[model samples]
Target: MQNQGLLKELIQSLCCLPGVGPKSAQRMAFHLLQRNRDGGMQLSKMLARAVNEIGHCRECRTLTETELCEVCANPLRDAETLCVVESPADVWVIDQATTFKGKYFVLHGRLSPLDGIGPDQLGFELLEQRMATGQIKELILATNSTVEGQATAHFIGEVAGKFNIRATRIAHGVPMGGELEFIDSGTLAHAFNGRREF
Candidate 1:
């Protein structure tokens, strides 16, 4: 309980990650100290390296090591179809589910008013810019069904309307208030297949 200086800083920094509470962070810190010193050091090094190397894809706003992510750079992927998601993690979940030939646009966050997150913060402006190119034929709204996620999807629908692009929201299958990241690949694939128009 009396952790100070470097140990306290490490625990506090670990708590910054989502779902990592003080207790969990403390456990993680101690785990690193006691058992996984080398792994912990590598993790720290990777985190620092990624912080320097990975950045948002200029086109879709997903995290990338370069100007564009793999999906954007892939010649085989359909550039005209765009899947919009709340974060880079959602993009990965969907990708793992298989055969989404279209590219993706990652919002990096959702519209949570309680936390003061809004459309601007979710990068709707960048999406509008992408749509303005007129090459995108469809925009898939894969945001979750939580209040904030739904709000974000609706906002995207409005933006899509201005560009005359077809907008669809991935169906609710996992559960109400559930997140895409936690859903199994099978369920996620079904949701993607069963998507409906906004």
Candidate 2:
């Protein structure tokens, strides 16, 4: 006998999520069907709402439900300094990890020629426009340590230079709890280069 169409479809759909394989999807489907129907329904509703309502902020490109995100709308944030990051997740991480009081410009993604993402796709024109306004005096490149991230940062630094804005990169080093043996060579080099005088 064939499996029920609705149950089979649910399992297949669940597999579309990241890291959810066929077995995991099947387990989740059965769990929801057997014991978590209410939670599953709520999750479905919320997911649909987020997908439909959330969009990139007009200024920073972070995910938001309004035209401007809370950060962009805040008047207290330093307009003269802008921190550039790859994604909204990076924005959250920086907000939690440091006392950065400046504004942000989220690139949304890095320069990946293979994936067809470039400066235009990452909203470089908008960033240039903001810089052209002469409000931003410094740009902090906070992209990741990957090659693509470094390339993106270099591109932004060049763009900032064109507008005569000072550009800087976030310092890369060993994490507080990271052991030197476990640290990568590139990170060690960066830490050495970025060492401060005692």
The number of the candidate with the highest lDDT is: 2
Best by TM-score: 2
On residues 32-100, what C-alpha lDDT tens digit does candidate 1 reach at each position? 999999999999999999999999998889998999888899999998999999889999999998678
Per-residue C-alpha lDDT of model 2 across residues 1-198, encoded as one tens digit per residue: 387799999989998999999899989999998999999999999999999999999999999999999999999999999999999999999999899999999998999999999899999989999999999999999999899999999989998899899999987899999999999898999899989999
lDDT of each: 0.89, 0.94
Total clashing residue pairs per candidate? Answer: 0, 0
Superposition TM-score, candidate 2 onto the true structure: 0.93
lDDT of 1: 0.89
